[model samples]
Target: IVLQNCMDTNEPDSDGLTPLMHAAAGGHEEVVGLLLSHGARLGDRDNRRRSVLHWAVLTYREAVLRLLLKHAATDDPLLIDAYDESGCSPLHAAIDSGFEIGVSILMEFGVNI
Candidate 1:
């Protein structure tokens, strides 16, 4: 597996997007799980300062959003409401993208409105 060979699971690409961010954005649940288990940093942000949660919501990846929420650390309250460079929170992204399920999931996870 690429993970087996790679040293840093949290390493970002030229665009500042980490593998976990990609998997979350693409709705690759299994890959996201694997990466997380392998020590991927959920807090890693893209060049635009979008968290993995943001990518999941922006891409309408509902299942990925749920998975991320389930794995997210409750201690980091800011994680749920992280703002991107454009000032879009995951909840805002979900509502703006018309991802009803995403909005519900984010609300269930306690995201601020």
Candidate 2:
């Protein structure tokens, strides 16, 4: 129904979060796959310039992060290095949040330290 309605996949909510971001943050891998298949923009940023990858890492959504990385634009450095208003990269967020698995996953994906 969401795709049939042509809902703006890139549109942000009041919190500057798109559906992709929310799905990734919540570790909803199936939803992430569905959204990506429906042409959801991987490069969309929140008001803080944070991408869905940032949300995934911050929330320790390892599976979602892996799914996102697979579909993310290879040319877009922001997917790995996205910094929020506080200048925290996805890797930094993982490390700061004490999510060891998240940190390792980001590192495996070759995120800039």
Candidate 3:
């Protein structure tokens, strides 16, 4: 299914899930590819200021995370400087969720602890 352009880049949906967030949270590699091809904004944040990486790490969605990293023009954005409303980032989320795979993925993408 073709996701609408607005829908692809739109902010978080119900339950604070963006297309990028959903793709990352669910480990949907194809969906993540479609979203990126549709020019979805990688840095788009949810209501909590959590980017795709945040949800990816939170849910340990490894497949989606790797796809996103591959398609991303930036190896690592200024995500290190970004924080959620509660002053947390994807790294923090991974640590909190105890997702070792997620943490490693984030680190591989050049995100510092």
Candidate 4:
């Protein structure tokens, strides 16, 4: 409900992570969808240059990962292929973090190897 107010859904917090990133990290699939619907930038990255997909994968948010993937347009491969400060793509992060489901989902989405 608060999101329905005149608030900037893309506003980043002190950590440079927007609400969509937070929701993705916490596995809040519904909230992530809501934020996206509100115009949250799917390609928005944090201070580390990690996209929302990275946050979801890093935290093992399988459902959120899938949701983000489904919403990503063909031209939005950058979201799946983004590399963070540590030089890790969401796929790399998923593998490193042992998010097995995420790895498969990311691959299924055609994320660059």
Candidate 5:
């Protein structure tokens, strides 16, 4: 029932993020794919107006980011010019978290300094 549940629970949380959003944010490509197959809306955003791509970058999940990009579900306009309420974008978060590989991955996608 868990898989079925995950398939059905595409609803947003208090922060307005669905299962797909969380999966993408954490770079859970498999989960993201699963949710997508179940019709999870790709354009959903969190309370901060961040899309799945934004969260994926912040979390430094390269696989997830790539998967999202492949699906054209990620634009990440805030890639370099965004800041969360705490004053941090996905890139900033990746750097602050000491995810050097993550920073590099984001750069490959054109996230500016």
Candidate 6:
């Protein structure tokens, strides 16, 4: 229905979270891919100014994080270092969340500590 209706993929909810943010938070890689293919903005921030990469790392969504990184690699390459309102970068969020794999992935993508 979303695809057929051509729904606004970048539309945020009351919390300022778009479908991409929710999908990344839930570790829904396929949904993230679908949304991205439909032009979902990877840099969209939530109410807290947390990007989809931040949400993916905070939630320990390894697959979603990878997918996001893959797209971001060619597009907005700086997204890996994006900071939220709290000044927490995706790398910071991943480390603080104790997600080793997520941290490793972020580092591999050239995200500085």
Ranking by TM-score: 6, 4, 1, 2, 3, 5
Where does model 3 exceed 4 Å of error?
2-8, 14-16, 73-76
Better candidate by lDDT, 1 or 2 = 1
Query: What are the clash counts of all predictions, listed in order?
Result: 0, 0, 0, 0, 0, 0
**What TM-score would candidate 3 get against the native?**
0.80
Q: In model 4, how large is the Cα lDDT of residue 25? A: 93
Residue 19 lDDT, candidate 3, scale 0-100: 72
**Top candidate (TM-score):** 6
- Candidates 3 and 4: which is better by lDDT? 4
**Top of the candidates by lDDT:** 6
TM-score comparison, 2 vs 4, better candidate: 4
Off by over 4 Å in 5: 1-10, 25-27, 37-39, 73-82
Better of 4 and 5 by TM-score: 4
lDDT of 1: 0.87
Give the range of the ten consecutive residues with the poorest summed lDDT in model 3: 1-10
Stronger candidate by lDDT (2 vs 4): 4
Off by over 4 Å in 2: 73-77
Error of 1 at 51 (Å): 0.6
Candidate 6 lDDT tens digits, 1-113: 57779889999999999999998898888989999999999988899999999899989998889989999999899899999998999998888879999989998889977
TM-score of each: 0.93, 0.89, 0.80, 0.93, 0.66, 0.96
Give the Cα error of residue 104 in candidate 6, in Å: 0.3
Candidate 6's TM-score reads 0.96
Q: Give per-residue CA lDDT, model 2, range 10-79, as digits (tens).
A: 7799888999898888888998899888878888888888888889988889899887876764636457
Worst 10 residues of 5 by lDDT: 72-81
Residues 1-113, model 4: lDDT tens digits: 54868789999998899999999999899999888887888988898888998899888998998999988855375677888998988889888888888999998988887
